[model samples]
Target: MNAFPPAQALSGRRPAVAVWPWPIALGLLTVFGLLSALLGQHGIWLALSWAALSLPLIVTVICLVRAWSRPSDKGGRS
Candidate 1:
């Protein structure tokens, strides 16, 4: 017998975000990026904001590609 339940049973029809950390990190990054762009100092602020915005997008893309190419379920079920 299987030691754990089936993947679908554990998934329980939850949203994708429930299983990913990047979504929450990306959200926080976006909010901080916006705030930095609006309220931060001039020079460094632009750089910081751009990095904040782009880093998550790049990471998300990389993660998506990796996840797509891989055959295993590294992040558990749904």
Candidate 2:
């Protein structure tokens, strides 16, 4: 038997949010950052590329920290 239901089953409704935008935006930013860093390695392009690259990393760290801080669904706490 399953210990818990899937999130979709629990929700039982379509999500209003469109999921593709953020991921697409992040991917574009990464691509731009890479191309800029490699192809435009001198002035403003380099700086913008660095900034763009760091944003994804910053988002990832923030998400990881938030997920780790949350209590586990498996009930680790007594």
The numbered model that scores best in TM-score is 2
Where in model 2 is the C-alpha error above 4 Å? 1-16, 72-78
Q: Write the residue-wise lDDT of candidate 1 on 1-78 in tens digits.
A: 112345644666533334456578889989888889899868899789999999887986887777677667544432
TM for candidate 1 is 0.55
lDDT for each candidate structure:
0.70, 0.73
What's the lDDT of the predicted structure labeled candidate 1?
A: 0.70
Per-model TM values vs. the true structure? 0.55, 0.65
Best by lDDT: 2
Please give the lDDT score at residue 4 for candidate 2: 34
Q: Report the CA-based lDDT of candidate 2 relative to the real structure.
A: 0.73
Tens-digit lDDT track for model 2 on 7-38? Answer: 64456553355678878988999999999989
Which 10-residue span in candidate 2 carries the lowest summed lDDT?
1-10
RMSD values, in order shown: 6.4, 7.2
Which pairs in model 1 have colliding backbones? Answer: none
